[model samples]
Target chain A: MRASVHRAVEELLSEQPAEEVTLPLIATRAGVHPTTVYRRWGSLADLLSEVASSRFSGDIVVPDTGDVREDLERWATAVATDLADPDTLAIMRAALGAGPDGGCACTADRHAQLEAILERERSRGGRTPSVEEASDGLLGPLYYRALFTQLPVTAEWVRGLVRKLLS
Target chain B: MRASVHRAVEELLSEQPAEEVTLPLIATRAGVHPTTVYRRWGSLADLLSEVASSRFSGDIVVPDTGDVREDLERWATAVATDLADPDTLAIMRAALGAGPDGGCACTADRHAQLEAILERERSRGGRTPSVEEASDGLLGPLYYRALFTQLPVTAEWVRGLVRKLLS
Candidate 1:
């Protein structure tokens, strides 16, 4: 039932805007009562936040190719690619725009991945940016472009960010 | 009348969360009818978007102190300072979360400011980053920290970003 509801949400989001994905519509599509959705998720914002957070949680496989720069470039490129998808962009916008605090708990997952990469780099006796630096330099720019700006965050651009950070 | 309505929005946003600022409440505070607000702004999101956009529009005085690095640092610091305020943060969150395309028309103002700075640098025979580079490096990280992460976007951190961009 949970899977069906989530699937329904994904389908609906891909088809329409986040504001239009009301509890009634979700419940109707998922073959559940509106009360059930409300009981489970409390609100649309909460539901979207949970779904976006879960989708972004721990699923980003941290790269470990021995070279930290290469690993980071690959990871950033992959993220850029993922965000290029309209569905993923919609989910991201929904997540960022959800809740009172702006629903950014999903950042923790990406932060963890960066820390892991930095740890691997440190263990390999290579000079590396602090996790904060990596985030400010890499993920910050990557997401800033994807969400806030009309610029296309290309693989080349993502790789350049990695190079700048390492440089 | 428009000014009063805008003031009401600003006051309400400063007083509470963006979600709580409804059309009827705004209309009541502004001493205007709900129908008037609806006729003027169409919906709550449109009203909020207009309010936020207008608030952010052309108000940022871009710094110019002969040196590109200093200029950008000061400007970025000023921005960081503005965003630290709860009122400004609330307005920003509203603007970002508003509209179907995420209500980022305000970025054009900042981009124009950056372009001005870069143009000055080029005319002075100093090698400088492209406007896009400045955005990706400076504005990207600055706003990324301000909006997404739990970390505070301190002046020291912002200055460091300027230095990094120049280096």
Candidate 2:
């Protein structure tokens, strides 16, 4: 039931903007009572946060090819590709709007993934940027450009970020 | 009348979240007719974008101290300080939500300011990061921390970003 409802939301989001999506609409699409969704998730924002986190967990797998730079480049490139999609961008906006007090779950998941990559690099005797550096230098710009500017996240730009961070 | 409406929006945003702020409410606060606002701006999102752009233009003054590194650090620190305010964050989110076809006016303003700083550096024969580098390395992370993460934009973090970019 939970998975069906989440899937419904994703489908709705693909069809329309996040702002236009509502609980009752999602309920009708999922063929469940609206009360069920409300009872389980409390609000659309919370539900969207969950769906986004779940999607991100599966969508962006961290890379580990022994070389940290290669891993980061691949990881960033994959993320950049994912964000280029309008659906992904909508999900990101929805996740950001909820603004969980503890921080958004999707970012937490990404941070953990980032830490895992760094930990591997450290164990393998490579100097890796702190999570902070990587976030600001690589991840932050991808999102900034996606949300704020019209700039496309190009291969050249992504490669430059990884090289700059490693340099 | 235009200035008053923008001021009204800012004042209302300071009192409540951006989502709750409406065009009619802004008109009421600004002492203008709802139709006047409607006819002038067309919609709440457009109005909010205009208000946000106006606020950003005045709020974040770019620095030109003849030294690019020092100037960027100070400018970033000031931005960090501004973004720390809930009101500024609300404005930023509102501006982003509109997703202007050309790009949000506030960011265009910031990008232009960033360019001015870079141009100054080049004219002075001082090596400076390209706008892309500065955006990726410095500005992107500040906003990323502010909007996406729970991390505070500490002075230490801002200084480190400047040093990394200049290095």
Enumerate the chain B TM-scores of all models: 0.92, 0.91
- Candidate 2 lDDT by residue in tens digits, B24-121: 88899999999999999887667766777777775677898878888999988997898788877766765654444213565777777888889998
Each prediction's RMSD to truth = 2.5, 2.6
Mark the regions of model 1 whose C-alpha exceeds 4 Å error after superposition.
Answer: A22-25, A100-103, B15-17, B20-25, B43-45
Residue runs of model 2 more than 4 Å from their true location after superposition: A98-103, B15-19, B22-36, B98-103
Model 2 chain A TM-score equals 0.92
CAPRI-wise, candidate 1 is acceptable
DockQ for the candidates, in order? 0.47, 0.44
Candidate 1 share of real interface contacts: 0.40
Best by DockQ: 1
Each model's lDDT: 0.79, 0.78
The candidates' interface RMSDs, in order, read: 2.6, 3.2
Worst 10 residues of 1 chain B by lDDT: B97-106
